[model samples]
Target: MSEALAVVETAGTDTTVPAVSGARQFWRRLRAQRAALVAAAVVALLVLVALAAPLLTALEGQDPTTYHPALIDSARGGVPLGSFGGVSAEHWLGVEPQTGRDMFARLVYGARVSLGVSLGATVVQVAVGIAMGVAAGLGNRWVDLVLSRITDIFVSMPLMIMALALLAIVPNTFPRPVLVALIIALVAGWSTMAKMVRAQTLTLKNLDYVAAARLSGWKTWRIAVRELLPGLAAPGITYAALLIPSNISAEAALSFLGVGVKPPTPSWGQMLTSADVWYQAAPQYLLLPAAALFVTVFALTVLGDGVRVALDPRAASRLRVGTGRRRENRARAAVPENALPEKALPVKSLPEKEGPA
Candidate 1:
């Protein structure tokens, strides 16, 4: 009996469970959230649309800059003619009020500018933030103080006002989208990321592995690159995901205020700027770009939240909230009974027939 029990215990111990990698686990958790998956799909579609702007415009046989005067009603303040803002076979999404530019063409092309600036700005912000954050976290007392104070100063400044002031002074000779992205990055984009990184670094630097690395005579740069950076990636990626929508909104606000991308380039915000005056005459003009912005922002925000939850172990419970029962059932079915803990094993009752006999 003792030998049999030992054999059973060894069998249980010998069963090898396949290890799931961190990336795979994260992907699984993210995929489990239906809303996040849908949002991801929507974001992907928008990105595809943005990237294929020229192809889409070419297929529509309309250039963003070309005007179709006949499609507009000059007699009535250049309101688009026909029903639904002049939407027809030739112009799939109708034409602009005064200019008669193809709405579809402008919208698809505008996506390129909006997404380009937002994504570019995000990259700049994240790069600068990590550099500043690591420097502050790893440096001595005075270094931390200087960087932290600078970060606080940037955080406190009025973002919109500073962006406006800076953009207004910059020469338009520079590539508009790149200039806008850089200005956005400079004014207010990086402070949050830096702060988060600094806090995380301060905590991570005290860990045993980091100390071990230090004792191993590793340089500060090497420790930061090899030790701290991997630890920082999760939060950095999560924060970066959240930052994209904010940057998109900022870009739109700047453009709507006439300080962003100029005309002929066709940004969503620039479209909204023109759309504002035409709301009474042509609601589609306002509604199209407004809806596009709302959908993109909403989708991005949802996806970002999903990423945050997926990356955080503490938040794992939140993802399981609605699907708890199904997940539990699936887990119970998938896990072999023998692989369960010894404490969970069934206890066999001794035979009592011999005593009665």
Candidate 2:
């Protein structure tokens, strides 16, 4: 019996339960944050719209690039001629001023451009940051110093100024959208992520598991990949989430400044630029794109904050669960002090039961 017990114990020690993937765990934690969940849903919807932009444009049979001077209300300064203040069944949102293009079609297609640039840039940024950060954290002291200095240089430099200089110098032969994304990623992507990853790696390196891996003669790269990287995922991803909105806003600002995607590409920023002159006549033109940008950035920011809070051990306790307010109210109402006295007290049995028996 003792031998069997010993064998069982050895098996238990040798075969550890498979740990959950970082992505899976992060998702679980994110789901705990209600605001994050809602924000994620909104983000997902936006992504879906962006992905299906072409199909939706086709279904509506609206050409974003084609001019429709006939549809415009010249009386109202190029607002779409319609029943409800330039809005009609034919032209859902309205038409543009000078171009007279379908506003709705442009708006839908513009989502693709904005989301594509932001998402692509974010991916590049996070990947580069994680790689450099891990190397710096795990490498020798000299390596760490060099990488840290490089990171410091980037941190000190204003990203917009650098980007403007680069944009001006770089030839226009490059695809505008791709160039914009690449520029943002290369210029501003890695700094924050790298710092976070390095901090996490430094903390993880001293942990017992990491030390055990080192003692077992595990290769440094293997230890970094298998042990340290998993620990960095939560913080890295949370930071990446936050950085996405920043990238999106930056892209918009650049596009507004005429350094982004060229005309007819249907970017939200380009639309905003076009609407500036026609604000009084066709206010919807300005309002629609601006509102969309605001909502998108706001949602992403909130979601990112929620993710950060969810991933933080200290913040976990503060995360609200269920329909928070309602749940709290119900719990408080059901407490002993709030309940009726009779219901709160335990029932007592009468001794007269013996006489009945």
Candidate 3:
């Protein structure tokens, strides 16, 4: 028993585990995160719906904007709500106020706006933030100073109030939903991502890879594009993925405030707005849009969290951050020199009891 215990202890202390590549390990961890997988699937479904919104909402060859008197009066109009008295067979979501449009079809069409705004805004935000952060981290003293001050200014401001005011002015000129999303993104979405990118770039700028690239006469832009940016990829992707929900909420808030996508445009927020007064009578109307928004935001948050955990450089680290390499070497050093366990050495049968013999 004593020998077996000693052998078990020795085996447990060995550290001959295989080390996988960082990228492959990250992917493996991500695939294991069930919440992220489900969220990704949900987001993919929404993207598909956004792409097919036109076909999804098509009613008798009429587009979502087309107003049909019979359809409207009968709760089949392309609206974003259904009537309260009796659910319409054709318009599962019901009819809109006064217009009596088919709410289901409009809701179907509304997916395009929600997804378009969220995705486009995120893209714009990432692009602007990446440029700003790269510039700041590339050792531009004056540029860093200016951008830092700008970031601080926005950080101090109330983003929502500013977004609403801007939306009121901006949507009138640019009726395009994507453009409106882009504008909102430029104002609100860029700051956080920019700060993150700048911090990351600052850390990575002095790395040996960057030094090698510079020594090889690589241009600043090429280094940033090829070498530095890949280092930023994991965090950037995580941030951008989470940024979609914020952008979506911003669009919804704008719509709720009556400045988003104008009338006749179907949107999750618009649907909620129209149902706010009627929620007491029919709660489902409000619940639908609210639920959609909830799912979108929750999904993004989950995906971001999973990504952070999966891509964490210290995912395998049990030691302190700076002590990682030393700990790894120490672990290797702690491994047993013998391949066989001490107990497995034929258990020395008490020297075959030679004394008794």
Candidate 4:
């Protein structure tokens, strides 16, 4: 058993487990950050709430449109505002100005639309980006050159202006908010992914693993996925996740400008729009949605930053300095029990080379 354990340890056959352990280590590092963990927990709970949003008010047919004026009209009715306007049970966050809509229910319902657009846009972005990236990556030199230049052209295009222009051209009947988001995101997403994939592909094209596979006569797509893609997974996940916030922001901006998700639908931006007329009279109505937007964006950005830091090889190297001495001590104690003696040589300047001359 001991000999088998030593063989397994020395032969380095459990390479696949490192991927799993690295993921575990990432979560462990994230957990070490108390604030980030709490923020992450809140984000998770929000995701759950967003998923069950339909059940919260759907069965009885309650929606953002559900208005209760008599309760809202009272100075201290069932709806109460918190510190923003003082807590009330009747219409939490108070009622919308003049309309007396249940801001609480509307806020909850808005989660669906906000999350839907954000997620849907992200899905489209990742799909289109990955396809474009992979195509640009696999193409010949001239193909890569032309594709890259096209990406640059799109990069130079004014995104918001383009979305507005495209929306105007595609009749309002056809350019629904989701379609608008998909189009705008596709343009931005493809360009960004193409550039990144090109750079990565250029670096990876000659990597030992990919080269070995290619030399073995593996099909191009098989080598691309089996060897090249695993290396790209870290960046791919991080980038796709980060792009979500941008999509959400675009949705909100378009909604604010009256070109986004149609009104009457519960959306963060549309929710805020309802208060545009009397922000002074009913500040809670506006502030709540805006705060929600800010928190969601902030959480996603920080989470993305954390993933980038953890995924980076250089960042992972920091663990050595912090834990090196302890590991060294353990190895020293275990040295006598092993067949080979450990040396005190510096790694970067190893003095010995074992080979036939």
Candidate 5:
């Protein structure tokens, strides 16, 4: 008995479960989400297409700026001559209604501008938001007050009006896409991210590890960089993912308003601006850019939601959504039969008492 007990003790002591790193765990969770995976694939394709725009355009034998006047019918209000907006062997998508610029070339090139502006704007917003949020959360009372007020002021400002004013004032010499991105980042939206970060910081600062770090005489900067930033990353990333689609839409809106990327530059919004007039005569012109914008935005939104669920599984549970049903089933299957709850186990009924024996 003593030997058996010793063996049991040694076996128990030696048994160890391997620890999973956060990155691996996150990736594992993200992979389980089918919608997220699909969305990721779409976003990847868009990025790939955007990066390969020049090569694609070269192969199509068309440049976005070159106009083929012969393809347009002046009798029909400058509409493309052939069916479906002049689609042919040469033009995979079709030609523009009036200018006869290759739709495929303009679309791929437009992807570059749209993606670049939104991505750049998102980066700027994240940087500014993190800086402001962390400062407000970690700073003294007076510092917090000032930052909070500043954030409020930013939130209160009308984004469209501010963007228009700024865009109007800036010299036209600067690259329009870059200028639009900067304007979008500066105008509004960062306040929400800042607020979220600030709240998270406040909660994290009061935690035991943070308190221990402070007691160990670590400086504010060091503690923030080492301790607080890691905790902030999950939420920050989730928020940033959601922010991209919004920024893209905002850029499109700006372009639609004639204050966005200027002509000769093929932005989806600018395309839409021109497409409006040709909707009745050549509906294909309007549909193409609109569909592209819709798909990109929809994919991004779904991906963001998946990312949010992956980063915080509890969030899915809280919403009563079955996002992890497959994961849950796999987990359950991995557990030994004996480890299952008693309620889940088969129960044998006791022999019924003989009646009137």
Candidate 6:
């Protein structure tokens, strides 16, 4: 009987372990997404570099804004600072065309601008979206109708055109990067995030847990905050992660169009804008910033996809099928590494009594 109990307990443990760890399970799921994992690493590295830009520039004793006109090669139409215009001891990525500012320093500093705008806008967008979405989802039909219509109107409007029009009216004295982020967040992000949140809230508000909370006399605010919010986190975060790259790209485009962070600020888009004029003389100048932008966007996109898959087992299965990789790894990812498989759990055998005769 004791041996049988032990076997039953072991089986129960196997079942219980999987349900216990939400964070750990999410991590295991994420680990299965190889592309997403790689993207996350790259994003982390880029962020570190962006954060360390000041330290790196200080170490090099180079000011990004300071022009080294003498370094420019006038003999070659004044495009490069050196013979090759790339990978030199003094300048890692070579100098700007005419200004001759250190390429490495500008690149690093530019990352700061790009990241700052993107991250800031994303935060605002997510917060506003979540608030409006939750409100709409949990509210009565009239409230939902009003908010949903508003969201639809915003969604129908062209974001770029509206932003451009608004930006043109704003005073130049106002901060460009901050202003851009605000415009982008207000115009582009909230609608989509709100829609997603609303859809999720509609589903979650009717769940058993929510019913339990309501039955316990929890206030509406408490129910929304405690019950629905937790359920919304996975989708909200995944959407926000995906939104970041779009925000970054938009900021860059604005800068490229010359309405962004003005000259001497050193943004990726600004660099591209300037590089285009000198492309014939030094194509490296054009390629460097473009490549950085591409990498940043790609990494964010892949990381977002990974997070989405991590939170949803169905998505993970689809990812596995699309990738056409080894099935064993995907199987491992779906299950927590610390937990033993049902077949692997130790079994205690019952002792057999020997016959007396």
lDDT tens string, model 6, 1-357?
122122235645733222336687899988877888899999999999999999998887786898877888777677665565744777777888877888899999999999999999999999999999999999999999999999999888887788889889999889888998999899998898999999999999888999999999999899999898888888888899889999999999988887778878889999998787777778888998999999999999888888888887676433355455566678778888668556666889989999999
Q: Name the candidate, 3 or 6, with the larger lDDT value.
A: 6
Q: Which residue segments of model 6 deviate by more than 4 Å? A: 1-19, 74-77, 316-325, 328-357
What is candidate 4's local distance difference test score? 0.70
Write one digit per residue (lDDT tens) for candidate 1, span 1-357.
122122233545754344667788899988878889999999999999999998998998899999999999999999999999999999999999999999999999999998999999999999999999999999999999999999999889888999888888888898889988998887786998999999999999999999999999999999999999999999999989988999999999999999999988999999999787899899999999999999999999999989998899577633346688888899989999998776766889988766654
Candidate 3 per-residue C-alpha lDDT over 62-108 given as tens digits, one digit per residue, 9 for 90 to 100 = 35565545543335333334346235655556555545556566666
Off by over 4 Å in 2: 1-29, 73-79, 83-86, 316-330, 337-357
lDDT of 5: 0.91
TM agreement with the true structure for every prediction: 0.87, 0.82, 0.75, 0.76, 0.87, 0.84
Worst 10-residue lDDT window for candidate 3 reads 1-10
Best by TM-score: 5
**Can you write out model 4's per-residue Cα lDDT over 91-203, one digit (the tens) per residue?**
44556655566666677777777777778877777766666676678778888788878889988887778777776676666637577567667667657876787678778
lDDT (10s digit) by residue, model 2, range 1-357: 112112233645754344565556667877767788898899999999888888887887786899988877777656666643356665678777766788888888888899999999999999999998999999999999999999988878787888888888888788888999999998896887898889888999999999999999999999988998878887888888898899989999988888888887899998887778867777888999999899899889988888887677466533355466897898778788836455557779976645654
What is the Cα root-mean-square deviation between model 6 and the actual structure? 9.6
lDDT of each: 0.91, 0.83, 0.74, 0.70, 0.91, 0.86
RMSD of each: 7.7, 8.4, 11.3, 9.2, 6.3, 9.6
Local lDDT at 212 for model 1: 100
Cα lDDT of model 5 by residue, 237-278, tens digit: 999999999999999999999999999999999999978888
Clashes of each: 0, 0, 12, 9, 0, 0
